[model samples]
Target: MPRTPQPRTAVLASADLSFRTRVREALTGLRWEVQEAQGGAEALAYLEARPCEAMIVDTWLPDLEIQEFLAECEKRHPQTDLIAVDDPGPERGPERTQARSPRRNEVLLALRRGQDADHEPQGDGASWNGMPEMTPVHDRTVVREEIFVRGTAVVEATRPGAEPGPGTVRLPELIGEAPAMLEVSRRIRLVAPRAATVLVQGPTGSGKELVARAIHRLSPRANRRLVALNCAAIPDTLLEAELFGHTRGAFTGAVQGRIGRIEAADGGTLFLDEIGEMPLALQAKLLRFLETGEVQRIGDNDPIRVDVRIVAATHRSLAEMVKAGSFRADLYYRLAVFLIRTPGLGERPEDLPLLVERLLARMAEQAPVRRLSAEAMERLRQHAWPGNVRELQHVLERAAILAAESPEIGAAEIEFGETF
Candidate 1:
């Protein structure tokens, strides 16, 4: 008997009902198990709960901005394939008619033709002196399809080893071979075995969370859960309940008993990202937990003891925040038992080529990978990655998409702009 084919998993994010229907139909034909989301935030939430093999995101969404959504996707699911789609406007003029042609078809044609130019009109048109004319157009359907296929293949090829079993959660493996990365790895190994609470400081997008995960994976609590909570992301009102569990009748809409993150990571590591944003009152509670290894669930009189280790990270300078009185000095002292400062992408320019190579290799699974021009690499190295490694990944991902329809990524394709 023949074995059944594994279902291709995908998350489709778009608010347009008709467009979503069409996309779903196309993916269904390709034997994909399609999950739908109305916007970027919803898409991200879906991905966080159950990561898919590939994500098809519309450039425009109501809830979250496009670039931000893509960045989050890259950070959370680096191995998953990403395909961005843009709408083709009315089919009126010569350009409009060409734009209306399926973008997936266009991308596929470009890849097949080994073309390095953007989509351009071909053949004769109504013109003075009856001359043939060609013009560039923007619909990239063929390219999108090619990208999807290539990305899916890469995800399969580089799927991380099976999910770490209970008491053995796997963390994000840092991706660089540069001297900076070597030092970071050495630091992680040195601090992993000890029960010290670690503080990871870096600029936003510098992969602070990734560094935290590596520490957890290498630490004595490697066999436990590595629960991560973004302090800045959680609202101040509910931050307390999120970090510490609340009883069924604790507060408004508290319908059921819930286990907070600290307790959930009982025998593992609790990674508090953007720890500087944690509220002043909550800081005291956290400090107490660290000192006594006990957490008191909200609305409960008793404190529950847990054996979890804490790994906190932040992009802000806590020392400055402490001076400003926005953050607690005592809490910082408790969390910073060990400190590992992560270097930004610009700080380690030597790793650009290796990082670019790995990104292209992953991108190749979605389309024919293209080689970066020397000028392109030089230009990339020159830019100050304020968003750090995350920004670099986005730039490369976008370049890959642009180059997937061409044979090479040129200086123009390496365009860098302001990213928040």
Candidate 2:
């Protein structure tokens, strides 16, 4: 019997998730498998752990010096082919990109075609071969930490307007090593860099917004603003103006033309919370903008083009709404290009201990950090957790405050608030 050849594996070392996503989406089905490195260090480590056939190194590596990394690769693994992807020219900001693939005419063609698919008309359109271009992963000059897990690399992006300082805390804490939590992280890795819209579905308080933030933090658009608007919190009367802006004479209260949330979030992400609550009329306008990338201010004839990524979250079932004619089927399909679900607290009880620890840590910044007794923890796990993580945090905060000057919170101190 003839032997089948093993598929070759390749490594992609880059801090830019957008670039990585572009390459992967372009080369959807090739003989070789692809792995990712958060930065040069992770890539080197991955290469050492198991030698691969090739490594695609991005120009702006966050963790290690690009030249030094290239030298190390050349010296350590002389046999592994190296293909460097560089920016086409100077890019202005985090999201601006003009990339050129390896000089070697190999798998890069697939990438070029994939990128062309992004800008070209949907179907029957071939990738533009005339311009040998790659999306530039621009202005990533800062150094940061790298975390490698399983077969993927994770790195924090430097966001504009919300840069973290030495004393600043990023996320309160993820607080889970369980499989469910790990899977959430994995999904973030897969979807963060892609330009596709992401719909995060979960019960209220299951940390859907947190998942959205994680995706933005890991995306190329991190440096740009992440505008979060709660559809349910805002009144239906004002939702239209809030989303699409209004010209000075459009409505009775309109004093001046104002850019709406969609316009404000250009070149970044717009997180729509409780999307199921958005009015059906507004859904039509939103669908128009999604289709044309153009927003028309209320009572304005001109349309404005704004580039924005949509990360929508809702506890309600949109599928049910679609069937019920509450949500437009077309708009639902546009928003759900990619989907991620946040598990409710009860679904992953094993994470309760870590969750308690993180919540207590967050509470410490406000008050003294307290420890949970086993009895208190057991009482927590015993509850149904109908409200999920948000409910848990509220209970813990109340308990911590009620504990007063005590160093330890007893089971009696843990109170279950009004059950959802």
Compare the candidates by TM-score and give the number of the best one. Answer: 2
Question: Each model's TM-score, in the order given?
Answer: 0.58, 0.65
lDDT per residue for candidate 2 within 28-131, as digits (tens), equals: 46656778765554577678778877778765554334554666677788767666564232243343222223333455665565345344442345322122
User: Considering summed lDDT, which 10 consecutive residues are worst modelled in model 1?
Assistant: 141-150
Per-residue lDDT of candidate 1, residues 188-239 (tens digit)? 6546656788999988887787777666644535545789999989899899
Local error of candidate 1 at residue 388 (angstroms) = 1.1
Off by over 4 Å in 2: 1-173
Per-structure clash totals for the candidates: 17, 6
lDDT values for all models: 0.67, 0.71
Question: Deviation in angstroms for 36 in model 1?
Answer: 45
